[model samples]
Target: MSALPCPCGSGSPYRDCCGPLLRGESPAATAEALMRSRYTAYVRRDEAYLLRTWEASHRPAALEMDDDAWLGLEVLATEAGGADDREGIVVFVARYQDQAGVVAEVRERSRFARQAGEWLYVDGETHP
Candidate 1:
């Protein structure tokens, strides 16, 4: 079977992008990669993966995946979130449709930290 496109908008097959990360087979190498995998996790409604990748300080007790349908993800920019960086930032936009079919978008500048060779999501600043 052919691989599906990654929801992270990475233009690569899921197996080559976020699939491994989501499956706990590999850790995200960079902050941007971690951000992309997080986006994919949202699309797949993989709450466990989300929680695992989240920083302990910011991780919520649980995630609720209701009726909202995630449509797409767009990565806008990145700063200092390379393989060797301890800290990184990623700006992105996520689009979704609610129960009423109303389209909505959330833009955010997210922070990430690398600890013990793993990238963890810290927090995000949502854009109005």
Candidate 2:
């Protein structure tokens, strides 16, 4: 069974939580910290971190998130995953601001994979 009343308010819980992600053990947390950190990377324009964490099969030729457009992040939910239940998904919403300071949003259901026990971001299904 999945954890409930997720601490991040994503409808998931602590044990089945983003726990691993928070511990830096799982690419996807067993909580929301991993997703939050990833969002921070976008705001900080940390392309290297992003690239290093992306799965090779899905790594982009030129990946970028508008620095000025990135605002903050919120992890909605996560699922148990993996070869040993190590794979997982993070449902989230990333908010940002344009150069004009206009607010924009990138709400997406992001997929994350654990390779060799390392959590590498795979991709996402973006929501408008």
- List the candidate 2 regions with Cα displacement exceeding 4 Å: 1-33, 81-84
Return model 1's CA RMSD, one decimal.
1.2
16-94 in candidate 2: lDDT tens per residue? 5544443345554332345554664565566666676778999997775654756455767777644455567778887
| Per-residue alpha-carbon lDDT of candidate 1 for residues 51-127, written as tens digits (9 for 90 to 100) | 99999999999988877888999889999989889999999999999999999999999999999988999999999
Q: Candidate 1, after superposition: displacement of residue 84 in Å?
A: 0.9
Estimate every model's Cα lDDT from 0 to 1: 0.92, 0.62
Please name the candidate that would achieve the greatest TM-score relative to the true structure.
Answer: 1
Each prediction's number of clashing residue pairs: 0, 18
Clashes of 2: 18
